[model samples]
Structure formats: structure tokens, C-alpha cells
Target: MGLLVVKNIGLLLTMSNRLAIADAVVVIKDGVIEWVGPSAEFDLDLYQDCTVIDADGGLVTPGLVECHTHLIFAGGRSDEFEARATGVPYAEIARRGGGIAKTVKATREASEDQLFELAVPRVYSFLAQGVTTVEAKSGYGLDFDSEMRLLNVAARLDKATPVDIVSTFLGAHSIPAEAKENRAAFVDDICDRWIPEVAQRQLAVFCDVFCESIAFSVDESRRILKAGLLAGLKPKIHAEQLARTGGALLAAELGAVSADHLDFASKQDAKALAEAGTVGVLLPGCAVSMCKPDFPDPKLLQAAGVKIALSTDYNPGSSVTLNLPLMGSFAMAFMGMSAMEVWEAITINAAAALDLQDFVGMVKPGYKGDLVIFRGADPVGPFYEYGGSKVAKVIKEGSVVVRRDPCGGVTI
Candidate 1:
């Protein structure tokens, strides 16, 4: 809570164009970064009472931000995963009464306490991999009470965990079985009933929609998002994941914060997003889990001047992993993203996706004192060596919250 100093950093990545620095020092006072520079210029004697942490010549960067995740779900989908392995398409699986609907049943059946307990370990997993902030969506709950419960659990997670949990209202995630006969009526329920209540109760920061062939149409998505905007929630869209349904274009038109899973997004969509200043959040983990080789073209997005961010897309049915570094590896190996791009995706760019750029996701002065110290000198070690934990320490709000020993024992 007082003065804290992290000294002797071998390589520091500040998520700027001039990214890396050597022998760096970061000074924090009362949970905010005060200074960052070379250790030689930092005189420890100038500070009378300060707690110092030796980085041991490790890699230091701002704490990772998971901008898109379904972290509040109540069940797993191991069976559905196996079903997909046998060459069944995701759409076919959904038709067979699986996927999001299955998770919805489980989530709706769960008590708030049960959902909170299930989610705490998942948050811990994110923290273990240097994630200090995550955006959790309430998609599994299609109905109002269930959706409100999910948001409440997310709020509890923010207060209970070391990491910050940003909540999104995703009542337009999927059409429930009860409303399958009257899809338009259900859409009305979302816009007219759910969104206003969510806004009035201040339950969520963003309103998101899954705009796809399997979910809501472009027009329906627009209606829901417009209602959210009218009720004071910012817009985010799950766009073009399985197919191109004009979701990205809608996101650009609405000036949403982010358009995610742009596997089918065209260069024109990229240009639109760039013009609108919408961050294109790519999810490589989903591609790997679904056995889909196609990934969002980072080069095309960059060429169009679209800011690209990356996320784990951690969910029950697909992309069920908390390792953001593994996602970086996937991005480089499959999506052709550079290590610097991967780092920026998980840090500053991702924070921009969540509209938290000024608060977190940078090592500069006045940002939150949240950082990760890896076990090696190379800042790209996590992406280079994909599987294992390279994190040695994680600092949140000027305090060391996680420490991993040489033998791989973790203290949190």
C-alpha cells in the first residue's frame, strides 16, 4: 500500500513502439506507477521507506488483460469437445441440443454461490498466467433472472479476486428453447425488458451480441445493441466467428468498442473497424479447439490500419483455456502475428478493447501498478516456449499477488 519498487529488470516491455528496455526499474506509490526507467538512474537511497522486489534479471511487462471471455459459466463441455473430434460440425452439434444451450441449462440450474465458487478457480488460472483484468460475459443466461444472476456473480468476482472483472450483458447470446417458436418476441424481451433492467440496475458495463447464422441476425443484433446504447451500456459484438453475417459492419457502424472473432471478416470490414476506431479482437484458441484452420488475417487488419487485440476466448464448449501466453503462441504459429504484436494484443490493445487503456495495461507512470515478471531474460519466452508457466511473479495494485518457485510451486 506504501512505496514499492521493482528493480533489476533485465528486459522491460512497455507496450509502446519503443518496446523493450534493459536493467529497468519501476517505482510505485499507493497502487499507482510513479516512475519507470533504467535501474542505474534509480537511486534507492532517495526513498526512505520502500519495499523492494528484486526481479532477478527477468522479463517485466504490464499485466495481461483478457478482453473477451465467458468466465462465469457453470459447466464444462468435455463430451461436446469429444463429439467435435469425430468430425461433427459446431452447427450440427448445436442442432443436436448442445453448445451454448447446454451450458445455459447448467448455469440456470446453479445457485449464485455455486456459480461464484466455480468461477473463482478460473480467475485464479488467469492470474497464474499474469492476467490482472478480464471481461466476463453473461451469455449462458438467456432469461432475465438468470442473466442478472450471472452479472451479480461477476460483480462478486471483482470484489473477491485480485483481478478486475468487467461485466457484459449478453442476453442476446442465443435464443432459448422456450422462445424458439417466437424468436422476434424473445428479441423484444431482450431489448424491451432485459436491457433496460440491466442498465437501470447498473449490472453491466457493455452489452454484447453473438451475431451469426446460428445466433441473432444483423438486424436483431442492431436492435439489441441500440437498446443497450439507449440505456447507457457500451456495445461489443461477437462478430463473424462462424460466418460473415454483417456483424463486423454493424459493429463499425455502431462504433462499438470491439468486434471479436473475425475469421470471416473481409478487408473492407477491417477498414470500417479502423475508421471507427474499433479494436479487432482475434481469438486463436477457438480456432485450435474447433479444428478450424482459418484465423483472422492480422496482416490485412494491420494494412487497413485496424488495431488488433488477442484473447483466449475461454468458454465451456470451445477454447477452454486460461493461458493467455498459449494464445500468443497460437497467434504467432497459426495467425502469423509477431511476438511484439502478441504482447500488445494481450496488454495495451486489449485494454483499449475494454475501454481501460488509461487505467491499466501499461508500465508507464500514472498507470495501475500491475505487472508480470517472467522467469527469463527474453520477453518472448512465453510465446517461444508455449506449454509451461514462464511467470515467476505477478504484481497487482503495487503488491505481489502471485509467486512461483523454481520447482513450479505457486503461492497466491
Candidate 2:
């Protein structure tokens, strides 16, 4: 194998605190980082045919990872957006035939091919912002065939795009209107019919339930998640979003990999998450869009020794934005996280939520060479820039998949 050298790095934000910044050159070979040391120590003659990428004193960091997203769905919620802007309450709209149900209707009506074609541009939107990996969930389809259609489309979209997409089966996101009176039956369908088929086909990697007041109760959520585990899918849950129903506690009890949307989580929930080793995935975008008074207190969670991760929670109804840099900035400004802390949350911690931390989160020897270069010296500026800066370049598996600004822009 040959080496590819990235030299003249302005600053390297390695995940290690001691080795956080290095005025060094990184040597990559066959899609893995081979060596990282001061530029002067480089033996340029060792690899004659290796590709050379000059960093030009720019920031080099591991590619951004969107730990949670709803990037696989059809139809837009622009009507809901307009309604919300007019000072209409979100609950009011939901009561009047809107919200996730509207999306469910739209999604169920769309064909699998239609869903995949619609999702391609959105996936690129994430990649354009330097996000190389995203964990997407299929929750809009609350029924058997529609849910399977959503997941299959998501799988196909993953193959079509450059981004690594990990799908989560969220059959319990909500009970469709048809199942509104038969909630228990809907849960049964999710556990018996949906989980078995999806798990048997390996259509998704994780199983998620929206454990909310209007969705599944704590007991129902536990039952569905347990079934998913039996079917060989890892557990994740939407907990404490609108209100504190002990959903976080349930997630901790079940040893879920991650518990998301802790808008109303308490100090006790934080402690349980810490003890259970469940990562907390916070979505400020949803909070911002819904104008919900509750937002997760990251400081309390960190104090409890719980790991934190940030995500877009990108969806048509609640949050329509795919700009993770903006989410990072919002994570800091609104969620009360530091710039460095938010960066770590979005990269390493986010990767951990998807169980990909070891391979793709940080830059190190033997780690996958998934890299992103930013024009500014700091990753924080992308958030602070309010989406002004472009991703200079992106590399996946040691291949330059995206590079532009031949001088400083991203090209793919």
C-alpha cells in the first residue's frame, strides 16, 4: 500500500486532550491513518507514488457525524411551518390534522422509489455540511407496509449517497389514526409483525420508540424495545421530549444505547442515564422549532457523568433544517454547552450513539481516514458563521470523495 500525506495543517483537533493540537503532518495509507508527527520528521522519499494534499494552514478534523436524523421521508411540512410562524400552537395543529400524522399520510402514500428519490438531495445537504455519517430513523410510517417501505427506501438511499446511513426502525413513533383506538394492537403489530420482518431482513440496525404521552406509554415502550432486542436490534428511544413521563428512566432500565429528546429530563434521569451507560442525544432544533419551554440541561447530565451528543433531528413536521453546523451552534448557544464540548458531542459522542465511535469518530492511527477540512481555523466558526462557510474538502476511507475550492472549496 502507498501513503497519502496531508501536510501544513494549521491546527489538528485530535480528540485526545493531551494531543489535541499538533503542528504535524498526517500520513494515510490504504484508507487508514498510518503516521502522525511533526512535519520535519517526514521522510518524503518513502512514498514516491502517494497522493499529497496540502492543508494550506487550514483546520483538519474528523468528519462531522449527525448521530440522529429523520432524513428518510417524503413530502415537506411547509404548511405546518407557515402555521407555526403565524403563532399557532403545535398541539393545536396536531389536533387539527397536522404534525407527524400529516407526514405519515404523505409518507404512506408515496412509493418506495419516490421516497428514495426525494431523500437523495437531503442526504447531500448533510454531506455538503461535512457530515459523513448520519443515523436516520423511519417513524413517519406507523403501519406495517409503510414502515417497511420507509426502511427499504432508507437502505437504498444509503447506497445511493456518500454518507454512511444507519437506519433505526421507529415503528412506534406514533399510533396512526386507524390505530388510535387500538393502541395495544398497534404495539402488538410493531413487536410481532414489523420487528420480525425488519429484523429478519436486516433492514435496520436499531429499534426506536417514541415514548411520549400521545405515543407509547412506558410499559408499551418497554415491551416493544424488548421485542426488538429479541429480534437482534439495539434499543434507542425518544424520551422526555414534551413532558417528563419517566421515559428516560425506562430507557436506562432497558439499557438503551441512547435516549434522545430529553427536553424535560430531570437530574434523576441524568443519573440513571449515567449509571446505565446510555448516551443522551439532545436536539435543540426541535426545541427551537416547537418553541417548547423545556430543553435538556447538558450541564446537569455532564455533572452526572452522562455522555452527551448533538443531532439535527431533521424531519418535515417539527424540524426541517439539515444544517448540522447550525445545530452545533444552537447546541452551544441555547443548550448551554461549550464550543469544544459541542464539537465533541457531535463527533465522538454522536458516533458512540450509533456504535461507530471506534471506527469513524476521531483522527488517529489505525482509525478510518474519514476527514473534513474547514476553511476557518476552528470548527466553532462554522456554527458561529450561521452557515456561511463551505466545507473545504472531505475524505472517506482514504479516498478524496469531496474536494472543491481547488484552492479552498470542497470538490467531490
What lDDT does model 2 reach?
0.84
Assess every candidate by TM-score. Answer: 0.98, 0.95
Local accuracy by lDDT, each model: 0.92, 0.84
- The clash count of every prediction, one per candidate, is 0, 8
Best by TM-score: 1
Model 1, stretches more than 4 Å misplaced? none
> For residues 1-412, could you state the per-residue lDDT of candidate 2 as single tens digits?
3567888887777664525555667778998887877777888788688888887777888888998888777777787777777889878898888888888888888989888888988888788778889888988888888888889987897888878889999989988899888888888888989999999999999999999988889999999999999999999999998889989999999999999989888999999999999999988888667655556678888999998998889988777789888877887777778878887887888888998878877888887787777776765676787755557878776777776674545455
Residue 245, model 1, lDDT: 88
Worst 10 residues of 2 by lDDT: 15-24
lDDT of 2 at 311: 89
